[model samples]
Target: MIKEAIYHRPKDNFAYAYDKETLHIRLRSKKGDLTKVSLIYGDPYEWNDEGWKNSKKTMTLEGTDELFDIWFVEVKPKYKRMRYGFEIKSNENFLIYGEDGFIEKDPKNAHFYFCFPFLNENDVFNAPAWVKDTIWYQIFPERFANGNPLLNPKNTIPWGSTEPQFDTFFGGDLEGIINNIGHLTELGVNGIYLTPIFKAKSNHKYDTIDYMEIDPQFGDKKTFKKLIEVCHENNIRVMLDAVFNHSGFYFEPFQHVLEYQEKSKYRDWFHLRDIKVKALPEANYDTFAFTHLMPKLNTENEELKKYLLEVGKYWVEEFDIDGWRLDVANEVDHQFWRDFRKTVKSVKPDAYILGEVWHDSMPWLQGDQFDAVMNYPFTQAVVEYIAKDEINSEVFKHKLIKLLSNYPKNVNEYNFNLLGSHDTPRILTLCQDNKDKLKLLFLLQFSFIGSPCIYYGDEIGLTGEGDPSCRKCMVWDKDAQDTDLFTFLKKLIDLRKRYSAFGANGQFEVIESAKETNHIMYSKKTVEEQIIITINNSNSALKVHLPFDISKNESMNLWDNKPQKISEIEIEPLSFSIIKL
Candidate 1:
């Protein structure tokens, strides 16, 4: 046995409370190293003259990645607290793995086992329950629609009149969003994630000049309120972007600092080197990504923290917005976010607080900070395999298994999964304009766990490169739109909503991943039903075999609504099938 490869911990992903009563424990061993594993656990205080009184539960092989095999088991402790250890076995070797180290046999003392001291109800990570069922559509306000062209900014070009530039605007406003609520409803998304909408000089609005006021270009507070009303009426929740990390150059306090230097009262609000604070010839003050125009805020300042926390509370208290997507959230101090969560939840207990974090965000997702982070790891894995073709099916499965094992199942359900965003190339463009590949991408995204988000106009085949370009005007012309692609996505969304097994309620399992055929098969299963999906990423047709015998059981092909009994299924090139049993 490779003792060094065995690993476990009593907190975070390895072991955590899935809910108030249940604890999910996991153990990782070198891939294919262990033949069997089981959990030996009991309340720490429960003991007898013979030894510590405990029960053993066999652990199921959850999944295997490139280097590790994950074992999982769920237990509801009789006393809500327990000490646990693993009994691992290879062909002829046996070992007891615990908090201390490898042992020849189970120790009679509970101190030798890993301890989940207590399962406190307050410690359980609780994101809003509504998030599990939501399908999010992300909208860049300036590019979506122009319902009232009268509100257009000076020099605003005609919608979709020319290629997008950094400073260009097409006059998309909240009124436009209200006018096009049908588009979202028709697309089957239940949530809309709008980019930053507070008053700012730029079209993108990430550089906030004022946190409290809505940008006039997107309409006044009344129009925004109406937009919220309309969205809520249509059963679509709204999530606005919050840019608290930095302020635009034209932000009043920033401008005051630029003018008065050392004398400005807001001097402490920002990070400054010398009092001069010149933007030209390289800025002496800290900024977001060294951009001279966007000055990073000192969130540690009490006054500034209060102001930001109020901004968080105001939207939910006043407008009844469903959520807040924090931009550059990882850059801010953790205390500020904790306070922000407290403030926001004070007004509305279930308001979703999503953070923009591109990497592992376990620190911020402990139920105290962010409810969830933008799932970029999920995005990267999908893009690498489906869009870029940089990885085969086997490697893709490995990456996804690794991602799923990183967070608690509850956190994974609310994770904001997106394919393309304002920061990356459009999905269709990334797929090299291959609609087939794009369909496969959508199939995996909507079927996998998490609250999936669709980049505006991606369903209708809007294509572009990175930022400025990715932020293109929403294509409204039905004749020109890719209706076929839109219909494909709509069906996937419908499946996600109509069946529990096809959505977040099910457990994901990798059935098979064939590198030679470049095809993969996976299943989403619940106690009542199971959904099997097969995707062929290769150009040639492929036949995928089911692992178990299903000849006697009745099965239906969810795509075409036809009954099928074959254990082997053939999938066309760049296509997929959804089978329900």
Candidate 2:
């Protein structure tokens, strides 16, 4: 046995409370090193004269990555606490692994076992239930539409007349969003995540001049309230973006600091390297990524923290917004976010708090700071496999399995999954304008776990390379839109809403990944039903065989709504099939 490769811990993803009564335990071993593994667990206080009485339950091999095999098992401790150890076996060796490390035989002592002292319900990681079911549509306010051209800013250009520039504006406002409520409803989207809309000098509004007021280009508070009312009437939730990490150079306090330097009362509000602050010839003060215009806020300051906390509560307490997507959340202090959560939840207990983190965010997702983070790792994996063609099906499966293992199941459900946003190249552009490849990408995204988002024009075949180009005016001409792609996305959303097994309620497992054929098959299973999805990423047709006998059981092809009994299914190039049994 490879003793050095075996590992486990009693907290976080290794072992955690799945709910009030269940505990999930996992073990890691060198790939293909162990033939079998089982958990030997019991309440620490339940020991009698029989040398620490315990029960053994087998752990199933969850998945195998490049170097390790993850084993998992769920247990319900009779006393709500557990002392556990693992019994590992290979063809030539057997051993007991525990808190003290490997041993030749069972120690029969509770001290040698790993301990989970108790399971506290309040400590469980709980995000809002509504988030898991939501299908989010992200809107960049300045580019979506112009319902009331009267609110247009000075020098606002005609919508879609030219390619977007960094400083250009098309006068999209909240009234435009209210006018197009039918667009979201017809597409079956239940949530809309709007980019930063607070008063700012720029069209994107990430640099906040004021947090308490809506930008005039997006209308006043009354118009925003009406937009909220309309969205609620149509059963669509709204999440607004907030940029608390920095302030625009034109912001009053920032301007004051530039004018008065160290003498300003707001001098401590920002991270100024020297008493003499300057924005030209390289800023002496700290900023967001060295940008002269955006000065990073000192969130540790008590006065500034109080102001931001109020901003967090005001939206929920006054306008009744459904959620807040924190921009540059990873850059903020942990204590500030903790206080932010308490303040926001004080007014609305179930309000979703999503963070913008591009990497592993286990530190902020412990049921304290963020409900979830923007799942950029997922975006990268999908882009690499489908858009860049840099990885085969087998490598893609491995990457996904490893990602799934990094968090608890509940956290995975609330992850904000997006293909392309205002930050990256559009999905269609990334797929090289191949609608077939894009279709396959959407199939995997909507079927996989998490709350998926659709960028403003992604469903209608919008294509652009990156930042300023990705943020373009919304294409409203129905005759020019890709109607076929729109229909495909609408069907996927409808099926997600209609079926439980095809959504977040099911467990995901890899059925097969064929590198030679560039094909993959996976299943989402629940107690009552199972959904199997097959995809062919190559240019040639291929036949994928089911692992088990399906000749006797009745099955239906969910995509076409037709009954099929074939044990082997033929899939077309750059396409997929959803089968329900």
Structural similarity to truth (TM-score) of each candidate: 0.99, 0.99
Which segments of candidate 1 are over 4 A away from where they belong? none
lDDT of each: 0.93, 0.92
Q: Write the per-residue lDDT of candidate 1 for residues 1-581, one digit (tens) a residue.
A: 89999999788899999999999999999999999999999999988998899899999999999999999999999989999999999998999999999899988789999999999999999999999999999999999999899989999999999989999999999999999999999989899999999999999999999999999999999999999999999999999999889988999998999889899999999999995889998999999998999999999999988888989999899999999999999999999999999999999999999999999999999999999999999999999998999999999999999999989888898898899899999999999999999999999999998889999999999999998899999999999899999999999999999998888888999999988988889999999999999999999988878776788888899999998798888888898889998
Minimum summed lDDT over a 10-residue window in model 2 is located at 544-553
> Which pairs of residues collide in candidate 2?
none
Q: What are the per-residue Cα lDDT tens digits for candidate 2 across 1-581? A: 88999989787888999899999999999999999999999988876777888999999999987788999999999989999999999999999999999898888898999999999998889899998899999999999999999999999999999999999989999999999989999999999999999999999999999999999999999999999999999999999999889989988999998888878999989999987998999998888998999999999999999999999999999999999999999999999999999999999999999999999999999888999999999999988998889999989988898899888888898899999999999999999999999998898889889999999999999999898999989899999899999999999999898888777777899999978998889998889989999989999998988876777888889999998798689999898889997
After superposition, which runs of candidate 2 have C-alpha atoms over 4 Å from their true positions?
A: none
Error of 2 at 104 (Å): 1.6
